[model samples]
Each structure stands twice: as C-alpha cells, then as structure tokens.
Target: MLLFSRNLDKLFFRTLEKQLALTYATSTEPQREEEFRVLNLKHVKGQVAPRRPLKKIVPPPPRTQQMAENQDWGNVWPGPRSFHPATVPLPVRQGYVEKGVSPGKFGNAELMKIPNFLHLTPPVIKRQCEALKKFCTPWPKSLDSEEKCERHFPVEVSSSDYCHSSPTIRDPLARIVSVKVKLEALKLDARARDKFLRLVGDRYDEESDTVTIVADRCPLKKQNYDYAMYLITAVYHESWNVEPWEELKSEADMEYYIWENNASKVNVEKIFGKEAKDIPQIEVYSSAVDKYMNEGESDHTVEQYGQAVRKILNLPSLGA
Candidate 1:
C-alpha cells in the first residue's frame, strides 16, 4: 500500500510539473513571481508606433439652391438663356449692295472723230510718200507693154519751206485723181448722192468740192482707199514748194527723194550723171533700191545703207 501511495504521488507531481513547464514556455512574461524572465528584450526596447489612419476627405456640402441663387453661380435661367460665353460681334454694314456696270459702244460715224492733229510738213509728206511707194506693186499692164512703157502715176510730194502748219497752194497736176472717186462722183449726181450721204455722215461739203471721209471711221472699203489717196494727194499738193536739192543725211533718205520724182527713170539717170555707175556701183545702188521698192527681196531697213555710205565713199569698211 505504501509503494502504491508513493507511485500515485510521483504521477501526480510529474503531471503538475509538465503543466507548469508548458505554461511557462507559452507565456511571454513570468506566470509566477519566482519564474526566470529570459526573453528578447531588444524587440520590446524599440517601440514601433501604430500608423496614423488616413483622414477621409469629405468635400464641403454641394452649393445649396438658395446660396447658388444668392451668389448667381450655379443658377441657370430658362428659355434660351445665354449662360455660355459669346463671341465679340463683328462690325455690321447695313444694306450696301454692288451695282452692275459696263463699257460704252460707239457708232460708225462717231468712231471717225478726227484727232485735230497737225498739218503736214515736207519730211512728213516725204515719209508718207515713201510708205505709199513701198506698197505700189507694178501694174499688170507694165510687163506686157514694151513700146508704151506706161508707168504707175507716182504719188507726188511737194512742201513749202515757209509753211508752218499753214495751208499752202497745191499743184493742179499733183492733185490726186479725185475725179473718179466713187463717193464724190456719186455725190455730184443727185441720183446716188443722197443715199451715200445718208450712209456716211454729213461730213461732205458739196459746195466746196472738198469731201472729207475718215476711212478709219467709215465702213466702206472703197472710201478707205480713196481717203488714203486723198491724204497722199493733199500732202503732195501742199508740199510742192519744198526744196528738192537739199542734201539728206542718209543714203536711204536720198534714195527716197530720188524715188519720189514722178519719173521712174530718174534713179538710173542720176547714177549715170555722177559718173559713179561702175558695175559694182550700179549693183550696190540697185540692190538698195530693190530692197526699198520690192517686198520680194529681203526686208531692208535704213541701217543697211549706213554701211553702204562708207562703201559708196570708196573708203575701206570699218566693220562697225
């Protein structure tokens, strides 16, 4: 009985000791006052403070209707109220409309207004005559008529030295053959005159036998040619007193003067008269005259003869 009692006390003590050891091992601090307190004091020594909780940012209460109305901030008026911004108004111009316009037209008669230009001079008449002469093709009759040698009536040039745009006497012989003009002759007979007079304006002076039909302004082809002829005739008759022998500056001007004479054979005669009609001399002058008169040849201007002047003078060519 005593051995059994001793065994029971040993079992009881062992169980209690195991419970104490377990309790000691689990508890971080001493469970009883006499227990050893060996622990990691370094972790306890350094205090890790808890993180501060993030403050929830609650926005101020939405603007109240009464406050909005008072402040004039969020309150919007009704019926197409201009709450949004507007662009600056453009500068307004009222009721300014463009009108239609166009150029004017002139009648045939009105088109012919004479420029009230200058009277004719000798040089002017000569130049005009040269221009006319350039267009003068040989009449078809001249080629066949060997014996007759009938020539084209030269458009004449005569000028008074004293004439300063003053009207001078005209040569009766050089008065352009207005006798056969279609309009004038028509005017002479009452039968055809009125119709033509109506056709062209009343610029014709029937009593004076002086008819002025401006060709540029006139619609008729015959009138144009007649007007041209009349102009040449007027210049020729008006300039009759101009000196013919006055020495011209250039050979071309001299050639023009030579050709202006009524007689066609004068150029040949003039060359022969000066004893300068060598074969080469005749050739050069002939070439110059041909160039001036004939369109079949190359178009020759006055500058071409500038070289010929030195050639004619028997001077060596400067090649300028």
Candidate 2:
C-alpha cells in the first residue's frame, strides 16, 4: 500500500511540471508577437493636418490725406483729449531730429502723449455760446456803468478754474477765494475805518482804499468762498463796535498822527493863543504829516514837512 502511494505522488508531480511548461510557452508567444508589432510601427510616418493660406494685411488710408480744408474742426475734435496724429488733418510733426528731418505724424509717440486743445476753436466756442445763450440771464440795466456795477456788487469774488487729463481735476489754487471790496463801500466811520484797517492788517491797500481777503485753507471753493464772506461780515460788524478800552487810547498810542490829538491841539493853542483856529498853514501841516506817515517819505515830502513845521513854529524863512 505504501509503494503504490509513492508511485501515484511521482506521477502527480510529473503532470504538474508539464502543465507549467505549456503555460509559460503560451504566454511568451503573445508577448513576442506584441514586440514585433511595435517594432514595425517605427517605419510608418505620422499624419498631419493641411496648412491654410494667410490673409494679406491692408493698411488704412491716412485721415489727413482724406480730409478737406472745409471739414468741420468741431466734428474732428469735440472735446479735450490725448493727442492723436491720425485723426488730425494738419501736417503736424514731432520728435527730435536724428539728422535734419523730424519724425512725421504717422507713428509719432511724442505727439500722441501730450494734451491738445483742438476742440476749443473759435467757431466751436461761438456755437457753444449760442447753445448756452438760452440758459444765461441778461445783464442788469442798472449796472450799465462801471461805478453802478461796483456800487451794486460791492464784493468782487475771484477764483480760477483748471482742466487737464489727470487723476484729479482739482488744482490747489483753484479752491482759493479772493474777495475784494472798496473801503468806501462799507461806509465805515473814522473809528470803524481804523479798526477795520487794524483787523485786516496789510491786506488793506492804503492808496486804493481796497480791502482784499483771500481764503485758501478750506478744501472746496464754495467753503473758501463762504469763509471769506463770513470773515468780511465779522470784520465789518466788529469795526462798528466801540470797546471801552479803545476810549483809553491816548495820542501816543495812536497809529498815525492826528491834528485833534492833545499834543497837536495844545501846542497850536499855546502858540496862537486865542487865534489857534486861524493859524496859517494848519491844513498844510496836517496834509504834510498825512503824506509823510501814510504815502511815503521823499525829498518833496520832507521839504513840505519842514515848511509846515517852520510855519507852525513861526520861524523866519531863509528868504526873510
């Protein structure tokens, strides 16, 4: 029974080894066929899509060459913008010369980079004015004369406007408001005039008697304008007010020499005695002092002052 079992086991092993060799031969035959098929592909060329013909580029006609002399300028440029050479009809040129000739308008970067005011032609301005005429009110008949205009509009408000192609349209000086009015327009008395002058300081023009107030600290023009008007109103009202301390001011504290002051009046009274009012050259003396103090000192002013002084003191002239 043991020998029979051993012989059966040997037969089983032999059958298994033969089946393994057959399986290996079958797998290797398919792999060898795949390798031969891949090697054959190397000789074959790859297929490509057909190429299309390129279209020719046609250049545009020069706008300047096509434009006529009778063409409307307003139509060409309706508003302010960056310069464009092609749109402009003029034979304009820019760029520095390499030899004797400058670069023409066709491809001029310099011409296109800068600002242009071509839209603001005379004809265009006339047309714009005509269109805006309906919105504008007629000039007042009462303000026909310059004096009447000044009288009616006592305060003249001045401001500027700037236009450019930039990140901001606003200019620093554009917001500044300058208000001017004649000193006489305010109808201030001597005391008020002095106070107003003091309040305004150097802004008051003594020669022209015009007070000019400039407001620029504010951000907006309207705000500056309002501030200027408020300042003018405040100064005007304050000038009219009489402070108790102002009454204590003596001749020495006065800004300019006054004939009505204690020193001048007393001296004149003492010199002329009872006829102080009838003193000769009193008006001339006052005028001389005013000119010397307010107007300016000069050879003529000094001579006038000396003459007035000598006359007031009753000193004999060199001719006498």
Q: Pick the candidate with the highest lDDT.
A: 2
For all predictions, the C-alpha RMSD in Å is: 36.8, 9.2
Q: Kindly report which residue stretches of model 1 are placed more than 4 angstroms away from their true locations once superposed.
A: 1-214, 218-226, 243-274, 278-281, 285-320
Quantify all predictions' global Cα lDDT against the true fold: 0.44, 0.85
Whole-model alpha-carbon lDDT for candidate 2? 0.85
Residue-pair clashes, model 1: 5
Give per-residue CA lDDT, model 1, range 154-231, as digits (tens): 222222222122234333223232322233332234323433444444555657544453344334444545666665
Best by TM-score: 2
| Residues 166-218 of candidate 2: C-alpha lDDT, one tens digit per residue | 78888887999999989999998898998999999999997987999999999
Candidate 2: worst 10 consecutive residues by lDDT? 30-39
Which clashing pairs does model 2 show?
Answer: none
Query: Cα RMSD for candidate 2?
Result: 9.2
Candidate 1: residue 36 Cα off by (Å): 99
Q: Would you list the clashing residue pairs of candidate 1? A: 158-239, 158-240, 159-239, 159-240, 159-242
Backbone collisions counted per model: 5, 0
